[model samples]
Target chain A: MEKRTEPALSPLLLAMRGIVKTFGRSTAVDGIDLDVPERAFLTLLGPSGCGKTTVLRMIAGFETPDAGDMRLDNTPLADVPPERRPVNTVFQSYALFPHLTVNDNVAFSLKLRGGVVDIAARVRRALDAVHMADFGDRYPHQLSGGQQQRVAVARSIIAEPRLLLLDEPLSALDRKMRGHLQIELKALQRRLGIAFVYVTHDQEEAFALSDIVVVMNKGRIAQKADPQTIYSRPADSFVADFIGNSTLVEGRIRERHGDRATIATALGDVTAPAADGLAAGDAAMLVIRPELLSTRGEGVATFTGSVGNSVFQGERSMIEAEVAGVSLRFAAEAPLAAGTPVALWLDADRSFITRIAA
Target chain B: MTFRQRHLALPVAAAIVAGCLAPLAVLVAFSFYEVEDFELVPAFSFRAWGELAFSSTDWFLIGKAVLSGVATTVFTAILGYPVALALTRLAASGKGLAVIVLLTPLYTGEIVRIYAWRIVLGGEGLVNTLLQGVGLIDEPLKFLLFSPFTIALVLTYNNLPFMVLAIWVSAEMVDRRLIEAARDLGARPIDAFFRVIFPLTTPGLAAGSLTVFALSAGEMLTPSLLGGTSGSTAMALVDNLFGTAFDWPLASALALALLATLFLVASAMAGLLLRLKGARAVVGRV
Candidate 1:
């Protein structure tokens, strides 16, 4: 667990080009291209069965692609097995060997190599990285889920692999433990400086740790950008809806400026930020983030509707307002009673208009 | 313990003691009795035990029994492991049919199977005829039947299903993710097999070893019928002493000696296999 002295420069560590995999008649990963830079924490964010995990498995060499090529460290990964490749995966189940003690599990790869000088020292340092030094002698079943996950992470990183793939490693734990491990994982990634390819269905988890987030939908990457860009200006309507609980209204573009367009919808025309390929007549969807809608904010008046339902979360209350045969969800500081008529404000400058995904 | 389990334990315990331990106790007592006339008389004596201990022939036969058991156990383990692991990969219907097919040899009654083996392996048997007809050999092989080879081969074949079944059940319980994890942690397929698959299946291996060892070690019918010159066993000698020679004490002594020898061997095999860390992981340290 030697710490890297300098920050990782912009060198492409791995590249997957035109990777396609199909199970039976259904395509899992369809012609996807992904590039991971050195020391980059890239997360594939998608719902279940959206082929995000499939992409990670392909990179890990567990599932070979039906078509296309994968290269790691400038070497073709197609001919290399998982063991021979300088990559490892922390499985979703934390598939730790139950029979082996934590020390043995951490030292497994070193023993397999057969020429290590000091296995005990390496194992100790690896355990120390995950704060699991005292629990090396215990078996996997004796540890809790979170502790086992820490051991799994330690076991994967003991060999100092060039790239590490994690498949929902914290999904099995409680929220507090997951948050704790998320911070630890981000710090570990920064210190170790090894590129990580993580896959998770939780958007919040993906955004909390990833340097670059690749949002996927229906076996394709809908958007690959920084979390801020993905959240603010998604490539399509799918990416916006998938990343957050946003209200999408069907609209058609009326006119356009440099980065602004007027979308004619049922609630009337309003100016919003526009994505690429927007002409005067193209059909688009108005992306309204829930955070932008407020009851007491300085913004243009958007809609007047009756509140259908209101859920009071701890910080704010989420109110669903029905207007013009559409359900509009917006947040409020106080819980508005059902059937109460309310005026909602839309920060048109923050919202964007993107094409409707087929 | 739950009330149901506590109440059920007593009846099971009573049945095992009354059914099994009672017969063993009678044999132990009989081994210590001195033979009087043909009518009836019993007195404390160790003459039968002394003869059994001192006789070289008796020791040799006991050793042969142990060797036969160990050899068969080893053979069956090596052969059954692949079949059992393969069985785990099949679909449900295939597995059910395969299990039935595996147990087909046992269903054909021991005596009938022995006779059938005599026809298949005897001189001018099917194997010899086939080999000669194919011009592979000039004469029928002499050691095809009625030798130690025949005995070993038949004994291993007879007990193979049990080994396969035990190992198959154990291999089925192993999580598939562990193998992937092994590969992910820099292990080849062979390494995964040895590290994960083999270790996790030790409990099944122990169960199979005990069963095959016991069945092959004490086997009397197959060897007595198929093994010509090497057919003479301790069981046959004990039989002769009990019925033909009319010496109950010596028969009891020989029987008890054979039982003790097999018990010691089986216990050693179980202890060696089940003492593994993998076994302890599954069944807990015992």
Candidate 2:
């Protein structure tokens, strides 16, 4: 692989070095280094128990790291309590005060400051930002999940914190609402120019909203890069499997040629763009994305196989072909009949050969 | 007909009304009965009500009961909040143990607990001994026992568990995220408690207050047994009128007056508490 140049560095807003957190005997976050640039939308994406939320909590000062240093805006965050931190969170459950009206909830921080010149007007502006100005008189319980989420956003932003943290803010909503709010959140982040550290297990949500995506597994960062790099060239098998519907074929490197490597798999040897440092005889994985395989090609077929199962998804079909004791899943316009012989063409150039996950 | 969960409450409700209202009805009838030659007569009369209405002592005692109950409620509420909020931070197993420890004093009979308080608060008792040993005082505190302070102290101590338990349950029901959210929104720990934790748990505060008030207000034994001179209560007078004085009509009338006063006070307290925005948010939906 090419020696990738780091994206032009922006002034750092928050930086964490070797941050670690543990609960009892189990480690939740282990020695992770992270940086959030000013006005950057960074997302910690992982499965449950992957410590993504733990990282977010440490940033918000809710949970103190067991070890390591955290600095926000060049000041140490070790002794700064959550209340004193210039950071706010939009919790997954939208932890709005049930007793307070929408306007009061949004006006909370300003009121705590004792005297903000025009709290009501600022509250109006905050609620207006989330398009919830009319909900001022209503309590949290009176609002729907989506509306409550918008209020939570307004409540967090009214304080005008240097950074905003969102922990699965849209996970409770239905798909349509999730998509709608996803766009609104992205736009809001852009407009506010506040650094946002969002945590979610949903890969699509991460991709949709984040400028930098950090994929975590087992308390450690698996990959940190742009969405396109994370999607197209996953660091290892774990990132490849976690990010998309990519079929990983375990294999051994047959030869290494610069950025490309020939991986000897059960089906046969195939060369593809490979992760750096995979020498000959190293165990590797071939990442074959569903869209990279097709039934029609200009040249010869790569593998002849019989259809094992075909599932018809809306607007498309997922066909699994059994070839050489391996299942190759690919999406097609129409379902292929089971037991039918199918000739598949592998697009090797777009595929990735990467290291096996620990 | 199908039985719903609410249907189960009907029998209990009916039993409570019958058990409570029946005796009250008897008291009302007795208050109207005229006494003749040390024997109860069934003739209706307004003599007892007229006497009670004119008695300054009866009204003063009734007002004292209200003050005692309100004082105990306030003290318990102030003391209970810290304990209740602390209990919420305990682990699940620890919470169970804590609740058991909290209610252990109640397991002892009320009379037994009252006697125990005497041993602790008496001039030569545990508290005075400790204070003397620590050189905080040169002499055993005279006001430690058989005073208004003793009655108030014992009442607050005796009723604290109920208040703590009520508030603890409410504090536990308060989502932990709300407190965190408050802090995240720039609220200090104290701010979080006042704005989020306290408001949200007002329902519990209301419950605890009513319970502590009812339990402490009608109590005659604590004041009479521990309160020396200040121990005189309306309940004690009603008992005196019923037993030694042999004035059944007067006793019943005083008892009814005290009951009415307490009920009105309790209703007002419940109304004031439940009207708070926090309590309404919690209870209005349900």
Candidate 3:
């Protein structure tokens, strides 16, 4: 409701309502609604087969929604074919025209429409946007993977589409290359000031680029929020586990005190802030972010456990604590050896009590 | 290529070269030898070549062969592209069944197919009878089986499988995402086909065209058996000279001339198709 008062600030660019897509007998995208404000870097993030790519494809007009209404710039897009729609896509495989040169590939949309002023100049500008001006004479096969991807971006943006959809564009690149392109892509999106709907399963990529991240599971949106909220205050247990290393303890709510709930778990009575619509006697899951857990903290829900295993992950160590036959994984500053007595304290006030995803 | 790779291809390469070159050598030898009293005399002479150079009928037959090959190729390509593309969209099992249905006519020998065509296209054939029964025609269509139409129609029908199979394989290799990319980049379905799908499948088109051209150009029985009045071909003349006329020298000369003419035309067809940017991309030339 707050989004209605400030319509002038960031006008709606695209809105998809109650979208659903089914393939064969399996549902790829269940009923979901999404909105993108102008220039917003929104990403539909999920694991493989979770319908993130299908959603992107639907927006691009490659796949029609079985039931939904999509609007672009407040215009109904039900009858608009992909070619006529003011949207373009950067395909996962690049899909560069192998027969055409870089210049031709970038100028394709402009040339197809014809009568466009300064076609060559616009092509050059597009190529320059991706730092591929010097490679206009080369074909797709002559370029490296990252170079091909850059050309694909240049080609997709040459016509200056109102919205650009990227389907795992950096997925085919090497790890180091993916990181480099990720930063470049974020910068490009900012410069273009065009709304971008990106899809990826990589949590870090989503966090690094998206202004708003939509987490999905089994063809349904688990949570949609800014990256920080998605990380620090996940909406559910699945979102917590998917986005970061978070320990989820399943239990029944013993009592509710205004905005807080006391959950009775195997570990004992735990107190955390309750989610909306959650009440006493309801099945709840407590989300404890690994970063908030500490071995030494002042006055918190402390538990006694033995160190199980620790993995040194470059800058920090990921330690697992065994408490009452349940393994709770958390991060530690240093590597803790196995079979050592460990005193772990949970920051219960900083944690959340939310419903478990069905 | 590595030594092992080259070694692997060497045997087939030698076999192909030997298989093709040996026939050409025999034709050349026969062209230079004189036939006296039904006996081939080992006398090298330019008499047969000189006669062939001045014969308008021989040149006409050769020109007709070129025209036949080119026309059949054009017809099959225009007609086969849609069938090949449609075949690509079928399910796996459906495609297997479709291919069998596509090549079923081949299982029936050429003689059987020729007779079947006669039954379908003859003066009082099924088509004519149906047209008359429907009151669409006052009389039977006489030109249906014994004219240039019959020759062209029969040639196209006989060679369509080759065209469709070649182009279908090529069309299948074209990435479906490329079509989507084209559409996403502001191309209609037709525009996508012309710009993306057509260009990438040129190799298949070339292969099909070449195969159909060669097969239809060298065909003799279809024209003679069904063409009625316009059924004469260079191959028929070559057969007559070698068998009944006992004129191996002139026959060999005519055969060589026809072969050379068709080869030039085939090369021209290949050159035109492969020169497109789409073909070069597939073959990795550019």
For every model in order, the fraction of real contacts preserved is 0.81, 0.96, 0.94
lDDT of each: 0.90, 0.94, 0.92
Off by over 4 Å in 1: A1-8, A297-300, B1-3, B34-37, B133-135
Candidate 1's interface RMSD, please? 1.4
Model 2 spans > 4 angstroms off:
A1-9, B1-7
- Compose the digit string of candidate 1's lDDT tens values, residues A1-358: 4343433567788988998999999999989998898989999999899999999988888899999999887788998998898998899999999899999999999999998999999999999999999999999998999999999999999999999999999999999999999999999999999999999999999999999999988888888999899999989988878878799998999999888999999878979999988878999999888888777656555788899988999898888998887788888887888999878888889998998887
DockQ score of candidate 1? Answer: 0.67
- lDDT: the better of candidates 1 and 2: 2
* lDDT per residue as tens, model 3, A26-143: 9999998999999999999989999999999888888899998998878888888999999999999999999999999999999899899999999999999999999999989999
Better structure of 1 and 2 per DockQ: 2
Comparing 1 and 2 on TM-score, the stronger one = 2
For A1-358, candidate 2 gives per-residue lDDT tens digits of 3342445567788989999999999999999999999899999999999999999999999899999999888789999999899999999999999999999999999999986899999999999999999999998888999999999999999889999999999999999999999999999999999999999999999999999999999999999999999999999999999988888999999999999999999989999999988999999999999899999997889988999999999899999999999899899999989999999999999999999999
For residue A67, model 1's alpha carbon misses the true position, in angstroms, by 1.7
DockQ (0 to 1) for model 3: 0.92
Q: Write model 3 residue lDDT over B1-286, tens digit each, in one string.
A: 9989999999999999999999988989989999787799988899899999999999999999989999999999999999999999999999999999999988999999899999999888999999999999998999999899999999999999999999999999999999999999999999999999999999999999999999999999999999998999999999999999999989999999999899888899899999999999997668
